[model samples]
Target: MIFGTCGQRAPSVGESAPAERRKYIEEHFRCISDCDMCGICAVYHNQDPLLVYRDYIEGTRTFEEITEEYRR
Candidate 1:
């Protein structure tokens, strides 16, 4: 999978990502500068970060709710 500045795996040719994923990509992934200082894209290389934040993004769970689960 080709990883892009969007900090997620890029959709293949002719394939489209879900609206939520696209929104996240557009809002959070698009780099503002030439510096690749943020390592978030690298995290996507190993796993789908979206899965971890799905609940938070979908409004089903608050940030604290999801983070609390991991804190345990």
Candidate 2:
């Protein structure tokens, strides 16, 4: 099984994520500059950094989407 950013297997493309997991990720992750704890492109969408990275790698999501939705 392929584990996703959230430490669990990822769902197929276009599949909706679980609400609870999504909520947890939202509460815990934040995209910001001037920080380098994990060293991954996670400065948009206010989504889980790991998830963002995973999505990016999988080609399911794009940097543009993150910028358009979360970047201020």
lDDT of 2: 0.46
Pairs in clash, predicted candidate 2:
none
Mark the regions of model 1 whose C-alpha exceeds 4 Å error after superposition: 1-47
TM-score, model 2 to reference:
0.28
How much lDDT does candidate 1 score?
Answer: 0.50
Indicate the worst ten consecutive residues by lDDT in candidate 2: 38-47
lDDT of 2 by residue, 1-72 (tens): 444335644343455455533543444454446456643354543455656545533546643454345445
Question: Tens digits of per-residue lDDT for model 1 on 1-72?
Answer: 334454455443234335554465456654445437765545445334466556555565543454355446
Which candidate ranks first by lDDT, i.e. highest?
A: 1
TM-score per candidate: 0.35, 0.28
Q: Candidate 2 clash total?
A: 0
